[model samples]
Target: MKKTLLAVTSLSLLAACSSTQTVEQAQQFAPCTFPDSPTSEAPAWVCDVIPTDLAAGALGYAKKSAAGIGVMRKVAVNDARVQLAAQFQTDVSNMFKQAVESSVNTSTEQGAIENVVETFESVTKNVVSRSLTDSKLIVSQVSPAGGLYVLVGMDKQAYQANINEVVDAASQEQKLWHQFNGEKATEDLTNALNSLKAM
Candidate 1:
């Protein structure tokens, strides 16, 4: 009976020791970090470090084609320029719409506002096309699939300059409709220009 009890006690002690060790092992492992920190499951290169300029400027992506690297780069740059131009056009259009709606209440003023908006849109389209020709290429890399990946960036300052010129021209045209409308119209345009500059 004594020998049997000693064996049973030894087994119980061994089981308890194992359970404690298992818990300790689990505790030793650190908590998982995500996004910024790479994990064992995620490769280091998968965690892309975005450039500050890329973050600030408009981003455009394009894949390489059979046409060649030069063609691919041009396509990528054009894609980025188009994206930037579209964004600029949308923002300016919305700002101008808001300004006109708030400032022009009468039918006579409304006609003038419509003319000003049309002129502004036409001028903006031209400027957007011209401005993006000088946009900077931020990144170009070969993908794992053996195709080139290109990224283009355009600074807000450049876009702002273009916007300012358009606004100035539109404001001058808006002034011809009514002498009283000049100060308020100019103020609204200035406000919109300031917002673009801030961006």
Candidate 2:
């Protein structure tokens, strides 16, 4: 009776471990799927599978409403612009942080770096909003539920230009420039731009 009990306990533990491992593996390998529109299939872009030739893209949607398609397009486009701006701000912040941390010299004061980051955080939103005027609606779809979806993107060249403009503007901030090695920081930040494209 004791031997049987031990064997059953061991089997239960083994089965639990195996099931847990299988669940983890399934989650890791699960395929990406976009939510289908009521009337149409969702495009790959809706899942953020950007094309190789584009630097960045965003997906936006508006729920079914009494508003016409024009209103829907405007709402979706604005939503996409908001998303794209947020993404750009985050990417730029990461690039700046990497530049400061990975620089050959770390003599800049920590307080100064924090201040610069704060300044950039505020300025980046406005800059990105203006830059997004250049972004175009690549495709759009209407769901069976009468909602609208839009994919907004900027080409690689235009996206690069926007990055350069943002960096250049940041470098021009007199207070930030006076706080640290502005030229060196700007150069490192520029070098990091290539990584964004690859991502």
Candidate 3:
């Protein structure tokens, strides 16, 4: 009888633990409500979470502009473009750092690494500027206070094309790669290009 009672107690404790964990996970993923929403009912997109279907997305807002709704929308769209560009720059920078660190020896001068990073950043900014023109306005909403929220996204195909441009830029940067040599440098560069394309 005692053995059966102990088994039941363990099962009950396990069930309680599982339920608690599930609740915590749900809370973690709860959508953020947009501030100053015009109505209690706002679309899921307004929650500021980028939709999974988009390759890249950003949220932008503009307070009531003296110009007009069209101006407000343009301002908001531009803001989102800047944000998306920054995000892409950050992602590429991180990947570049990872690839270089994994392959390059620690003795490589810090200044050289920094120069390469700067070059990549400059190239990324230019690429993003050209590519973001292709992004579509996914949604727009106006708050009761006249603030406008705009969401913009780049489709996967367009995003991939931009990635290719960046990779090509990297490849053409002969001076940047001249610092390293051998089959390993070539292999790491190839790997980095592949990862960028995947992104």
Candidate 4:
């Protein structure tokens, strides 16, 4: 009777531990909510206008002025594009780091993985530029102070598709590297790319 009781107690403890872990994981991806008053430089509506999740592409904000409304809009849109590019770079770098850490196991493989990640980072800028050609202007308003405030959004599907394309191209490059060197030269890269695709 004591053995059965102990066994049930152990199972109950395991169940509780697993449920707590699941809740923590869910909380990590929960949508962010802004306070009644946002203290950031960005407008209060900015969070509502743009997705906080990097997987959902990126948001760019810009405030610009010019002699005419047309010129001001043009310049502000351009500035927003630059901001989006920077955000895209950061997102790609962060995702690459996560993928590499999860996929590569050996310290000896770190150098090769870093090289591939760096290459992917450089290639990501070009991919983002091409992909964001169709990005939409989500918010455009005239600030009370007299300049245009612009916010642009790129859809997550579009961003993922572009990243997939880049990964495929990089995979081809890794294939070539493998041929010139050895299969080991590209194994970490291939694993890392696979991990990214899983994300």
The candidate scoring highest on TM-score is 3
Error of 1 at 116 (Å): 2.7
TM-scores of all candidate predictions against the true structure: 0.53, 0.70, 0.73, 0.62
Residue pairs with colliding backbones in model 1 are none
Better-scoring candidate (lDDT), 1 or 4: 4
Model 2 clashing residue pairs (backbone):
38-144, 39-144
lDDT of 4 at 117: 64
| TM-score, prediction 2 | 0.70
Off by over 4 Å in 1: 1-63, 102-111, 171-199
Candidate scoring better on lDDT of 3 and 4 = 3
lDDT of 2 by residue, 1-199 (tens): 9999999999999998787786657545334444654334565676677777777888888877787899989999989988987887888777766765665246656787777667766666667866654678889977667778898888877777777677667656666555556577656544543443343
Q: Write the per-residue lDDT of candidate 1 for residues 1-199, one digit (tens) a residue.
A: 9999999999999998787786658545344222322342322122233344432234444464778888867776677667667876777777766665655544435566676666667766766666644457776655545444445554656556666766655556644334335565656555554554454
Q: Candidate 3 residues 1-199, lDDT tens each?
A: 9999999999999998787786657556454455775345555676766888898888888889889999999999989888888887777677777766665556656776676667776777776767654677999988777888999888888777777788787778776677556666556656756777776
Better of 1 and 2 by TM-score: 2
Q: Which 10-residue window in model 1 sums to the lowest lDDT?
A: 40-49
Best by lDDT: 3
Clashing pairs in 3: none
Cα displacement (Å) at residue 82, model 1: 2.0
Candidate 3 CA-lDDT value: 0.75
Candidate lDDT scores, in order, read 0.57, 0.71, 0.75, 0.62
Candidate 1 scores a C-alpha RMSD against the true structure in Å of 13.4
lDDT tens digits by residue: candidate 4, 124-156: 766666655555666676654555666766676
